[model samples]
Target: MDLLTLLDPLMTSPLLYPLLAGLGSLDGVLPMIPSEAAILTAGVFAHTGAPSLLLVVVATALGVFIGDHLAYGLSRSVLGPRLINRSKYARRAVAVAGRQLDRRAGLLIVTSRFLPGGRVTMNAACGTARVPLSRFSPASAIAALAWAAYMAGLGYLGGAAFVENPLLGLAVGLALSFACGGIVELVRRWTARRAPRAAGAADPGRGRSPAAASRGQVGSRRVRRALVSATAAVAVLAAPAAAAATPKEADRVGMRSRLDDVVATGAVGALAEVRDEHGAWRATSGVAELGRTRAVPAGGRFRVGSITKTFVATVVLQLVAEGRLGLDDPVETWLPGVVPNGRRITVRHLLDHTSGLYDVVETLPMPPGPEFLDNRWRTWTATELVARALANPPTFEPPGSAYAYSNTGYLLLGQIIEKVTGRSYGDEIERRIIRPLGLTGTSLPGTWPRISGPHPHGYLPTLRDGETHLIDYTEMNPSMMGAAGEMISTTRDLNRFFAALLGGRLLPGHLLDEMRTPGVRGASYGLGLDWWDTSCGIRVYGNDGDALAYRSWSYSTEDLRRQVTVAVTPDFRGDPDHVVDAFLDQAFCG
Candidate 1:
């Protein structure tokens, strides 16, 4: 059943508000109950014409407020002093919390509500420090209400964007909440590390005369009030300044230089496009063909190898959204007896590459020599591909135990799509994604042997008789890479497709969130997507594609505000990765 159908009863029930309140109260002590997710989901469902959004917010805030007070009371009456005296870590933590509270109690309490595990720490520390109940009560109330509004408001944004699917909206809201929490934590760490040391700032009870202690107490209250006002003023002024910032002309020049560096790494041709609030920037370097003076075309198509996995995954998710199939359904449920262990492997295992299936491409002959010329025109059926993989033992005994990239796994996915919808996977991609997004320059060529458009020639370097030869490897049948890496697309079309996909235009927000979730241990791959944490600490999502001589990389920020796509045709052996990495750093962080 669809998520909406499952959530309908909860949305209509009178107990939802009370349930949210109870969860929120429990979360104050446990910090693991996921009250935020519940609140965000309610907010999302409220936008779909169920219970009132304001009532939901009120219920959540009321619960959180009650919970904070309960924690404070318990700590003051029983747990606080005993723990502080017995544990070194507890003492240090409470001491630090006390100092911050002394300076900016109001801000600290409010901000801690949104931070996981922070609310408990701050409240316990405040109780141990014996802060006035009058001061703590007002801050706790404001923090509870503010946090409720912020979380629900994010859900409201997602709901507004995808009114047809409130569950999707909830996913979007959750993703946004995580991103915000991460940013806040990073800032907190940075400030903590850089905070200046003040002279005579030790605790008054530790190293101060009675006269000095009395004076310090009076000054602390004045400083706290001043800081609270200053914080509010700074927040108001900073918003406009941040919004005014944009990419400078120097940044474009730097990016162009980085593109040249890509060609310098022995690529015959390279092209890149970067999109942001300022606009799109296009750059190119090297030649269109061997021994030619013409530069690579600004708009050119290339065979985007495994990047096709994203397109295939998106289609599978769309089908799941339509209630056509379940992600956890066994492969054998759809295509009986095709895989030796089909019953044990799930659709999610295939999409996330944890199916333990052998990668048939490993068995294929793909030498970088003259022998490749003979097999370039050969085509293999999907059954033949799966059979080749099954001939080998499984990479691991149980499915979903480990991640092993298998093109053969996606090949099976293509077959499953065909069985479920009674149409080719390419047709579904065309109907659901390509046509809807107007991707004029993208196509799934079955056995087509040539790139049909304005494109640079691709080459592979081979050593024969102690000398290198640049083989013109542009034209080749891609059927061998069918369902996994056979699609052709331009950088512009790719950027638009990914932007739309990440911007919640293509699939339900929840499905996209699942696509972004890492499936196996110690792996960065999320379903079909690949994410990289850049040198500047910004996370971007996209996939890299590679064919015989063509290579491409596409990535975008979580908000879809910054995007980049780069592709290159090789001429010699060199590290093209250096170019891709440098270009991305310059584009997003310059």
Candidate 2:
């Protein structure tokens, strides 16, 4: 099971409410406690019916109220005087309460619950002063309720937008909470700066006569009140819309909205496929190509970029299983002298992107622009490409060092396969995987430029003569990418391939384990496959692909029961990850 799936039971446990309440109670005394995260997390769980929303709010309020009284109780205790006398902070707290808490205590208490450290200081100060229980208790109760409502309400809002991923919801809640605190701080500073000026002007003969000064002060106060009232009114009116977007409504609107959002941001076209036990849902938004009205093809093929790595890695692992290649064997054992540190780099290093080889494409003066356009038709040999990499210093100590993504490493791996089998990498892949799996929609186009059958036209944005131009980059030689990336496949073909691979149709169990084991720090890479911790808490394993004009991804749960695939042609302004996250959250989290 993925992390979120394992965490769901814990989040929904009946014991969670009391725990959250306990934390809330402590928050009044222990300002550092992350009560907001706990409350918001519980509130997020409420969206999934893990717990009732009313129960969560009430529990949170009860905890905070108990904590408030506990601090007050401590203040009235025999040791209260000694404690206040010994601690400078406590003495200062009392001074602050004496000056301001007498008048604006209610507002300060309510807002302080949202501010870090403010709750502990205020509650402690109020207790140290021995303020009447009658005066403090009722205000504390109301303040607790308001804080609970705001925290829970914000959590619910974020949960609506990010239902599958409680962590993301928590982060969003914290950001919103912090933003509220920041706005309050800014307003306080602004008011403080205005106070001295207003006071100086109010003095007789300082700027104007007493009558005129009084009128000016009144006008200034009126303007400040209007500003504060307007801000409050806008927030009150906007609250309902933000809180009312239910999960079902979010699901209904999210996918299309994400697609439209990406398109509007600059994508020429976007398409996605989500598959689960229920069935598959396909969606498309934006045009197939610029200046065309055709919708993106429903089952269109696009270059699956580095996604080809998975297929390549699978075949290599198959060879390892067949006793034809050794994972620990040095690259020098196959294509001797090709890489600078081939003797130190193992086959495993190549597969997991730990070879530390510098990416050959980075050496070029420009990529995917006018400079690349000049050489777009040039074919690149794998040996020639590796030589270009060798010409540069190794990116790091190679052969099992730091993780660095290098197309050069995969190209060398492809060459090694050719050396071992006396056949091109594409031949071995087709004979072993694609043909046997009946994936007719997939192909290694090599030097062939035209996309056959139904395919969306890929686009690349360029600047020429101070104006942006969308170029049709649908046709290009794949020889430059070679075995590393030059493959074409549709969403249907990708889904089939990943599902089969994850379902154990492609490799034995041990090899599959190896493929899923992340070997490098800070990257969830395992062989050609990688893992994504989605916004909805589930972990999905897949590879993402990026070409000059097209981008694609194929991901599946560990059990192969759920999957998502997407293809997009660049519109130049948005990242496809947002749409992918929303779509996968709905598909897998639900």
Q: Encode model 2's per-residue lDDT on 12-101: one tens digit a residue.
A: 678888897899899887677887778666665777777788887898899999999987666544355346547667656644543444
Steric clashes per prediction: 0, 6
lDDT of 1 by residue, 1-590 (tens): 87667888999898999988888777776667887568767765877878888988898888888888887766554344455446566545555555454342226788777666777767766564434455578888998898788867876677665466556765787688777778776776676566533311222111000000000011122332332232221211000000011256565777777777777665777888889877877777777777666567677677788888899999999989999999999999999999988889999999998999987766664433445466665656678878988999998869998887788888899999999998878767877887788776676755435554456787755445654466677766566787888777888889999999999998898999999998786788987899998889999999987664777889999988899999887554455667678889778887
- lDDT of all the models against the reference? 0.70, 0.67
Model 2 residue runs over 4 Å out of place are: 1-253
Indicate the residue-level lDDT of 11 in model 2.
80
Per-prediction RMSD in angstroms? Answer: 27.8, 31.0
Q: Assess every candidate by TM-score.
A: 0.58, 0.57
Using lDDT as the measure, the top candidate is 1
Q: In candidate 1, which residue ranges exceed 4 Å CA deviation?
A: 1-249, 463-467
Instruction: Indicate the worst ten consecutive residues by lDDT in candidate 1.
Output: 207-216
